[model samples]
Target: MMRIAIVGAGIVGLAAAHALLDKGHQVTLVDPGNNQQRPTDGNAGWIAHMDVMPLASPKAWRNLPRWMMDPLGPLTIRPAYLPALTPWLLRFVLASSPARIKSSIAALRAINAEALPSWKALLTTLSLNGHLREKGILSVWRDRNHFLRAEDIITRQKNFGIPLEVLQPEDLKQIEPALHSVEAAVLYPEGCHVSDPALLAADLLRLALERGAVLVSAKALAVEPANDAVHIRTDGAVKDVTADRVLISSGVWSRALAKQLGDNIPLDTERGYNATYAKGAFGLNRPVMFEGEGFVASNLDTGDRVGGAVEFAGTQAPPNHERTSAMITRLKRFLPHLDENQPAKRWMGFRPSIPDSLPVIGQADKDKRIVYAFGHGHYGLTQAAITSRLITEMMEGKPGSLDLTPFSAQRF
Candidate 1:
């Protein structure tokens, strides 16, 4: 059996570790002790198949000014960093062209299509639903013009056999009484939600430990390909870890580690903010997306978590609790009855994003035994299992379950 080292503990790393272990491989998961590293604890916990489009679409450019200037806006980009990311933005615009978007949407849809089956398999194996609600996700638009604009993209998405239901304003009102202000809604039947992603990951960690995988609280400093194994150096000590494979699923930090091995990926973190109300604002039967606002909400037994914001500066940016409060403010507009009196537990985490807003998933080089499963942006929760199975397949000398052409490291 091949020995593999996975460097991250987020959904991707956990998924990879699970897949590797199932194949009878020796796996070691390394993560820095809770300080400067990315945490998988704070996401809104969605496994959506409807959000198959890249963040850098035509509409992004149109809304750039407002997203940048308004701190409370759903999307924000630091103006100081714009020049450095201009080339990426240009490429994003190019990729959002009619032809490119069609192709991207196709690939994303394929990845998304694979998500449900993989999730079902994992859920069955784990025997813990832990709020694995298949209650569909709905995207609501405030005006007919917005829905009409999205219809073009929706038509192309339909070609991929995605299950989408377009709802009129009146129909949307019945579905989401809290959102009558919206003119229309698109319901994605295949979307999934997790009440608590952290609890889910904690369960996965428990399983990994039970399966003999070691979780080290040490930070990896560097790696060098030694005689037949890759020698890993951590902050504590240098250890000769002879592994046949190394999968980098280290989120935003993966870029630096991968760069150490001659891969240059321009990865930026999408700093996200979330607030959890211990007592739900109102009874939400499912997850809801506010399109024009770029925000989302979910009702869970534990509480209602309202979140959304894409500020691309760095994950370490100060916790702009004001932004989190603004999300609550925005929600009040949609669901007037939502009780804002409950104590809020605010959270922020960095989602590593590429310019095209696609994750990097594939073998780094044919000659080397390194694989990449990082830069998943916002879809890490959605694409975890599929990426794990694909990466594990590649490591086992078996063909990857899907075409990895779309998420190659060379694209950067």
Candidate 2:
């Protein structure tokens, strides 16, 4: 058996650890802990298998100017970070071309096609089937024009063989009574979501631990490759951990570590903000994406999670709870009964994003012993299981079914 070390204990890292452990690898998960509001803890846990489209689309670029006008809109970029973000923004614009969008969709769909089944298999193995909810997701629209414009995209989704249902105003109530009357809604019947993201992360880690996987509760400082082993230096009392292989899955923090291994990946952070209220407060049978608003609300076991803005602020930016407030303010338009006075738990996390919307998931350099698997962005939860399977196959020297070209670290 090989000793494998994973640098990030978020959803992706933990999932990888579990997969490797099931394959009889001696796994060690290296993370500083979730005190900094890990993305796994705060995400609107949608297993978005049908969401093959990338955010960097021609339509999104066209709406950029108007979205930027509203500071608290679904997409925001801090003024001070603009200069540093220019390079990434340029690539993002390039990725929005029709050709690039089509390619991104195909690559995303390739992985997402197995997302649900992989999650099911993993969850079944872990005996945590109840954690995943397949109630599906509703993409609701308030504006009549916006709803009408959704037809083209819906047509495209149908062509992809995705199970989708268009719900008119009258049909909305039967699907979700909590939501107020809307112009229209499209439901992805195969879409899934977690009952509680944080709990899922915890359970996955706990199960990994139970299966003889070690949890190194320290921040990885550096990774050095020696003759036969990769050494990981960390901040914990145990200064270093040596392993036969190392998988860099540290989310947004992975860029620096991958660079150490001679791979300068163009990974950036998509700072996401969210607000959570007491359980049963915002009643919803399934997660609902408020189309055009750049936010989604879901009823989780922990509470009702709201807010999902794509903020371009760097990793060090302070948490902006105001974005959550704005989302709540606008949400009242749909859920008029929403009590704004209810206390909310605010959170912010970084989603490691690539300009092309594809994750960097392959060998860092010539050494196949070290693999890179991060930059999943919003689909991290949805793609984690499939990523784990692919990376396991990679580390085991087996030829994986999916093409690694699109997810290569050097693609940038």
Candidate 3:
């Protein structure tokens, strides 16, 4: 069996490690201090096969101003950093072209369909429940004009065979009896959700331990590319570990390490803020999203979770707790009965974003014994399993189930 090292213990790394083990490789998973929470824990927890478009869409561009202004806005690029953020933003607009968007959505759909089954299979093997349910995702539109605007994209989704369904108010109520208010909602029956991402991550790690994967609680200090293997350096006086291959899945911090391997990926972190309210305050039988604000609200048996926004700032910037509260407040606006003042929990996690809103998932330079599997942007949770499976196939010197060209490391 080949010996391999995986950096980052987030969902991506964990999934990669598990796949490597299945391929009969001895895997060592590494990570930093876990000083910060991972986005895999706070995301909307969707595995959406129907919502196939990248975040770099024309609709997103049109709403950029509203998405940037209010500190509570969904997509925020700090005003002071506009000059610095222009290139990434510009490339994003360019990728929003009709041709590229279609190709991207096609790739996304293939990857997601390949991923969904793996998630269920793995979760079943681990005997862990993240409260995953495949009742699908419903996108509700409060404004008729917005609904009409979204119809064109809905057509695209239908063309892709995305299992689309437009529900009127009565149909919406029947499908989601607990729903408080809705003008219209479109359900993607092929979608799924994990009620709690934190628990899922922790449980997956536990299962990895049972499968003989070691988790050393120290940060990776450095990695030296050797002729036949890669040597990993850790904190304190711990001896360096050597492996036949190294995979970096360190999320937003991955770019720094990636630079060591000769890649100049334009990776920037997009902080996603979330508010988790105590049990039964808000009502939702299925997930509900406000496409305009990038806000999502769902009912967990224990509580309610409202996640929203994309703040292009680093850990250096203090989290805007008020911004997280805004997600809850915004949800209240959608459902008037939802009490805005209810005691809620707030948190923020960074999602590493690339210019094209696509993850980098391939090998690095030949001189460097490393492969990249980071920069998943808003869809990391949605795409992790297939990514791991793909990386594993490549590591085994076999072809991956699908083409990896679109997700190449040098796409930037």
Candidate 4:
């Protein structure tokens, strides 16, 4: 059996490890451990299969000035990083072209279409199906103009075969009584979410361990080709390791390693912030997306987690907790009755993002021994299982069901 080493212990890496183990390969998962800023733990936990639109759309450009003026806005880019981000920013602008967006949407849909089935199979195998809730998600828009503007994207999604149910104010009230300021809502019945993302991740890791996959607590520093094998250097207890193959799924930290392997991927981290209120603090039944506000409020097993916000700061910058506080403020304004007295938990994490909002998932070099599966952007939680499945298929010398051309590292 080939020994495969995967870098990163987040959802994607763990899922890939489990898939590789199931294929009877020897798997070792490497990570720094104590993942205080893991997106898998801090994300909104929504399995948003219908969220196929790239973030670099023309509409987003129109809102850029407003975001720049408001430091606490939903999306912001630090001034200090702007100069260094010029090239990537230009590519991001180009990726917003109609043709690129259409191609990206189609590519996203191809993988996201299998979200439910893949999650079901993975969860059942891990015996953690109880963590998932398939009650669907609600997207609410407060402004009439915003609601009308969303219709165009909704129509496009419908044309792409996504099922959406547009709801009036009354329909929204019937579904979620806590919502008061919404002009309209849209329901995607196929959507699902994890009740406890942290617990689910732990369970996935537990299952991988039970299946004989080793977990190494070390930071992967670099990777190199060593004849038919791949050599990986680490920073902690296990200084180095050599394996038959390596999969780089290290989230925002993946770009550096990819560069070392002859592929310069333009990857940036989307600094995301979140806050969780005590359990029973908000009696919301399912995840609710505040469309214009760019946040999602969901009731998880632990509490009600409000997550969303994009900061184009590099990975090393100290997190500005004000972002989390801003989300809480917006949540309070949305639901006036939410008890402010309860203790709320706050967190910040980085999401690996590519200019086109598509993940890089294929062979990294000409040798094909080094593979990459990172940069899922905000949809990593939704795409993790299918990504693992595709990686497994590729590793087994079989073509994946979905087209990998859009996700290839060479695309950049």
Best by lDDT: 2
Better of 1 and 3 by TM-score: 3
Q: Model 1 segments beyond 4 Å from truth?
A: 35-39, 237-240
Per-prediction RMSD in angstroms? Answer: 2.1, 1.2, 1.9, 1.3
Q: Write the per-residue lDDT of candidate 2 for residues 43-121, one digit (tens) a residue.
A: 9999998987788975576567878899988789899999989999899888988898999989998999989999999
For model 3, how does the per-residue alpha-carbon lDDT over 1-412 read when each residue is reduced to its tens digit?
9889888888899988888888778888776545555787777777765666688777787678766667677877676767777877788778889888877877777787777888877777666644587767789876767778888789888887678788888888887766654666888777778867777788778878889887766677667787878887877345587899888898988887778778888888888888887867666777777767578876665578888788876667788777777666677667777777767777888888886677888888644358889998877887888888888888877878988899887766
In candidate 4, what are the lDDT values of residues 11-98, reduced to their tens digit? 9999899889988999999898888887988888888888778888765776677777779989989999998788889999899998
Query: What TM-score does each of the candidates earn?
Result: 0.93, 0.98, 0.94, 0.97
Off by over 4 Å in 2: none
Error of 2 at 58 (Å): 2.7
Q: Candidate 1 lDDT, tens digit per residue, 125-199?
A: 778665488888988877678778877668866876778898767777777676646667888887778867787
lDDT of each: 0.78, 0.88, 0.78, 0.87
Q: Which of the two candidates, 3 or 4, achieves a greater TM-score against the reference?
A: 4
